[model samples]
Target: MAGPGVSRRRMLGWMAAAGAAGVTGASVVGTRLATAVPAAEVVTRQEIRTLTPDQRTRFFNAVKTLHDNNAANNQYNRFVLTHYNFRSQGHGVAAFLPWHRKFLRLFEAALQRIDPTVVLPYWDWTLDSQRPERSEVLSSAYFGGNGTGSNRCVTNGAFAGWQVRYPNLHCLQRQYSGGSTIGSWYSPGMIENVLNTNRQSYDQFRRAIEGSPHASVHVNIGGDMSQMYSPNDPLDWVNHAFVDLLWAEWQARNPNLANTYNGGGAASSNILAPFGVTVASTLDTRALGYTYPRWSGSSRPA
Candidate 1:
C-alpha cells in the first residue's frame, strides 16, 4: 500500500501491476514494498469499475463463498433483519449516518475475513445517470442486467440465479422500471449541491443528501433494493458506501460541525446501536482505518 501522500496515478499503477502479474493470490506481505506503502496500511475503498478484473473476481468469489457457506442459514438474512428491525431509528433521523456507517463497516469486515485483499468498492451512481444501461458496473461481466419474468428475477450478472432466503424463500430479484432498461441515475451536479450545503447541523446536511440522490437511487433500483432486505442485492452495500462517503466528505468540509450531535433529542445522544458508535466516531475515515479513493476535497469530478 502507498502512503497517504502517494499520487492517485501511482496507486492505480500498483493495482494494474498486481493484476497484470496475476498476483491476485499474492499475500499482503508480497504486495508491499520496503519503506513505501505500509504492510498493514494498504486499505482503500474505490469506485467499482476502477477495480481490476482479478480484484473484482476476488470480491465476487468471497461474497459467493459466504453465500454458499451459509446457504441454509442465509448470511444476508441477519443483515437485512438488522436494517428493518431498526428502520424507525435508523432512517430519516440523525442515526441514519452512524447506523449505516457501522453497517457497512461490519459487512466490509465480513468480506475481509473471507478475502483479505477485498476492500468494499462503491458504485458512484452519478456517473451512470446519463446512460445507466451502458455502465460497465451493471454489465453481465459484473452485477448482471435488469430483472425479467413475473417475479422480476435477475437472470444475469455474477449473482445470476442467486437465492435470497430472507423474509421469504425466493430467487434474487430486481424489477427495472422500464422493462429491460434502468432509469436516470443521480447526477454529479445534484451531489455537488448537496455536499455544498452551508448547514450548521448534521441533520440538515443529512436530510438534503438523503432526500434527493440517496432516496432517488433506492427507489430507482426498485424491487429488493426498495425494501428493508435491500442487502439481498449486493449493489445496496456499494450504494451505501457512496452515501457514507458523501457524509464523510460533508464532515471533512465542516470541521466545526463534525462533532455536533442532535440524535434522538436530549434523552439519547448520537449513539448508534449494535456497534455502539457515536456520530463522532464515524466522522474520521482514518479513525475507522479506511479511506475512499477520492475523498479529500477532490470528491467532485472535474
Candidate 2:
C-alpha cells in the first residue's frame, strides 16, 4: 500500500498504468488514480437540465428510474434485505461485497452512460447540523421523508437490544449522531476481511467522480434502497461519492486509533447483513485502514 505522503505519486502511476494498454469497452472508474487535470482545466459541472428550483424534483425522478431498473434486471433485488442478512444470503459470504460492488459500479455506470460525467453523490449529514432531520436536499428516491415526518424516527430491530447478539441494539428515534460504530470496525482487535483483501475500494470511489467539483451525497431513500425504496421503483442507485472522502478524514484524524471492536461476541443472525462479515468476530476500522477527512472546507455542487 502506498503511504499517506506518497499517494500523489502513486496516483500518477495509476494514470499511466491505465493508459499503457489499448482502450476498448473498459471503465476507468476503480483505477487507483484520482482523475486529475489542472483545476482551471476541469469542467466540473455538467449542464443542469432542470431549473435550480426543481433540483429536488429532477433528482427524485432520476433515482426513481434507477430503483425500477435495478429490480427488473436482477431477481435477487426482491430478496435483498435493507440492513441485514445480506452477506450470508444466496452467494457465498465473499461474493457479497464484490457482487454489490459490481452492482453499484454498473448502477453508477448506467447513470453516467445516460449522462456522461454525472457522478454519484453522497450524504453529508453534518451540513444539516441546525436541524438533524431536515437537510436541504430531501427526495423520496433515496432519503425517505420530510425531515418533520413520522418516519424520521429510527424505531425498530436492533434499536431495541432485544437481540442477544447485539448487546447494544435498542429501538429509539432514528438518530443522526456520531459513534454509530456497531457493525463499523471502529473497535479494537477485530478482523477486517474486506479491507484485508481489497484496500483499493477507496481509490475506486475516488476516481468515479473525477469531474464532479462538489460532493453530491444523499441518504438511501425509503430507509433502505435495497427494497426499491418505492412501490414501482425496484433498483436503487443510491451511492455516496464522499465515501472515500470520509474514509480519508477518519484515517487522518485518528491514525493511531483503528476501528475498535470487542471480540468473541456473538451477533444475532439477523444483523449480520449490515456488516459484511464476522472477521475476527469483531474488527477495527483503523487497523483495516479507514478515516473520515476533516472536510470543513469541502464544497458541495450547486
Candidate 3:
C-alpha cells in the first residue's frame, strides 16, 4: 500500500507495475500492493448483524441526525436526489456497480461526518433469504418492520414517520411484496455461483448480479425502496453496501481482471457523474479507503 497522501493515479500505476512484474502475496483484497498504504486508513465494512450494540446505536443515531435535518439542501436529501437524477445513467448499465460504489462512499462519508466511529454496515440478505420478514434487520430493534394502514407510512423503527422531499412531501414507507411478509431473496449459493460464472467479465457479472439478486431485494421491499427515489429509505445504504461488497469480492477473486471494465462502450476513463471520478479510479475499493471483511470459501464473512 502507498503511504498517506499518495494520489489514486500513482497507486493505480504501482498496482499495474506490480501486476506486470508478477508480484503476488496475501493482502486484504487478494492483490498484493507494491507500495505501502496504511492499514489503519482502510476501514472494514462489517455485516449489519456483526455490529456490536453500541456500534449499531451510533450508526442509527448518525443516520437519524441526517434524517432530522430535513432541510431542502440537507446532505441526506442531496443523496436521494442524486440517485433519482442519475437513475438512468447509474442503473442497468456497465457503470452500475462503479456508480453505486462511489455513491455509497459519499453517503458513508456523510454518516461518518456526524459520527466518525460509524462505518457503513452491509445487510447480507443471503442470510435472510429463507424468511426475510423474520430477519432481525426488520425488527423494531433495528430498521423497524412493515408499514401499516392505507398510506403505508413506516410506523416503527429508526425512520418511522420520517418525511422525505423529492417528487413531493411524504412519509417514508414500506409495503412488502407478499402483503404482510417479504418474499424470499437470493441464497448464498446463488451468489457464489454468480461469482464463479462471471469471474472474467465485468459486464456479465454486473448484469447477472444487478438483474437478479440486486433487483429482488428492492422489489420485495417495495414502497419507497422500489421507487426511483429509493434512497429515501435508509435500508438503501446498507443494501447497496452489500451489493458493492459482492462486486469487490468478485474483483478480489480475479486479480488479473482487476481493471477489466467494459460493456456499453464504457471505458475506464468515463466519469461517474455527480462525483466526477473515473470508472478506473473506483475499480479498487482499498484505493478508495475501504474494504469488506476478508473471507474464505463459498460463504461471506459474518
Candidate 4:
C-alpha cells in the first residue's frame, strides 16, 4: 500500500509496471488496464441522506477536528482557500473531475487521520430535488437549516457558532434562495443524457456536467456555497462527491474511454498543490483506492 500519498517517481514506476503487465485486445482500444493491482482499502462511499447516526457523528467529529486543528495548514479555512485560488484550473477543463477526485481523496485521508472510520459520503441532490430544504440531510439533526439574521449565518446544527478565518473572518453561512427554498437540481433524465451520450472525450463530459447540475447546485445553495470558498460549507464535500460519482459512473459506462484525458493542460500537469498526483494518475479511481456505491437497475443517481 502507498499509504496517504505516493511520490511522482513511485507513481511513474507503478504506471510502468501497469503498462508492462499485459496487452490484451482490450488494450488496443484503451478499454482495460494492463495490470489489475488491488487497492488496500475498498471504502464504499454512501449517500449522506442514508448515513446512520453513528456515521454522522464520525463525519462531524472529523470535520470538527479539521476545523479546529490549527496544525493542519492553519485550520480548515485555509483548505477552502486552497481550492478557491485554483478554482479556474480545476473547473471547465480536462482536470475538473480528476482534480476534485484528488482533492476529496486528500480531504478524506485527512479525515481518516483524525477518525479512520470516516469515509466521505455523497449527496444525491436529485433524490431531493423537488424539496431541497425538507431533505433529511438538512434537518436540525443533520447538517442543519438555513442561516438567520442579517449575515445569513447558520445558527443551528453541528456547525453553528463556528468561526472561520479565510476570505475574511466569518461564521459558516448559507442563504437559501427563493425564500429559504432551493429550487430543484438537475433531474435524473438530465444526468442520463450525459451518461447515455457518446462523450467521445473527457473534456466534453466535463463541460456538460460542470455547466448544468454542478453550477446549478452551487447557485442553489447561494452565499458561501456560490463563492470560490464553497468548501467553507462542509456540505460542498458531499455535493462534489456526487459530481465525482457521476464521473465514476461515466467512466464505468464507457470502459474504452475511461482512462482518456484531453483538452486543457497536458497529462503531466500538476493537479494543484498539496497533492503531487499528476493529471494522468488520477484517471483510475480504483488505482486511487476508493469507489462510489454502484447503482443497480439505474444508469445514474441511484
How well does candidate 4 score on lDDT at residue 210? Answer: 68
Count steric clashes of candidate 4.
0
Question: How do all the candidates rank in terms of lDDT, highest first?
Answer: 3, 4, 1, 2
TM-score of each: 0.80, 0.34, 0.84, 0.81
Number of the candidate with higher lDDT, 2 or 3 = 3
Candidate 2 stretches with Cα past 4 Å from truth are 1-60, 69-85, 88-103, 139-240, 251-294, 297-302
Q: How do these models rank on TM-score, best leading?
A: 3, 4, 1, 2
Whose TM-score is higher: candidate 1's or candidate 2's? 1
lDDT of 3 at 278: 84
lDDT of 4 by residue, 1-302 (tens): 11112233432332232223232211121111112224467878888867788998999999998788433244465557556555555765567788788888777877877787888899887777677888877777777778788998888888887766555667778887566787666667657777777478777788677665676676566667766667888888989999998898888988888877885467767454445568788887777778887643243433
Per-residue C-alpha lDDT of model 3 across residues 186-277, encoded as one tens digit per residue: 77887787788887688888878876577767767877787767888999999999999888888888888878888455556798776777
What is the C-alpha local distance difference test score of each model?
A: 0.67, 0.28, 0.75, 0.69
Global lDDT of model 1: 0.67
List the lowest-lDDT window of 10 residues for candidate 1.
28-37
> Which candidate number maximizes lDDT?
3
lDDT of 1 by residue, 213-236 (tens): 666565556677766567778888
lDDT of 3: 0.75
| RMSD of each candidate relative to the true structure | 13.4, 17.6, 13.3, 13.2
Error of 2 at 174 (Å): 10
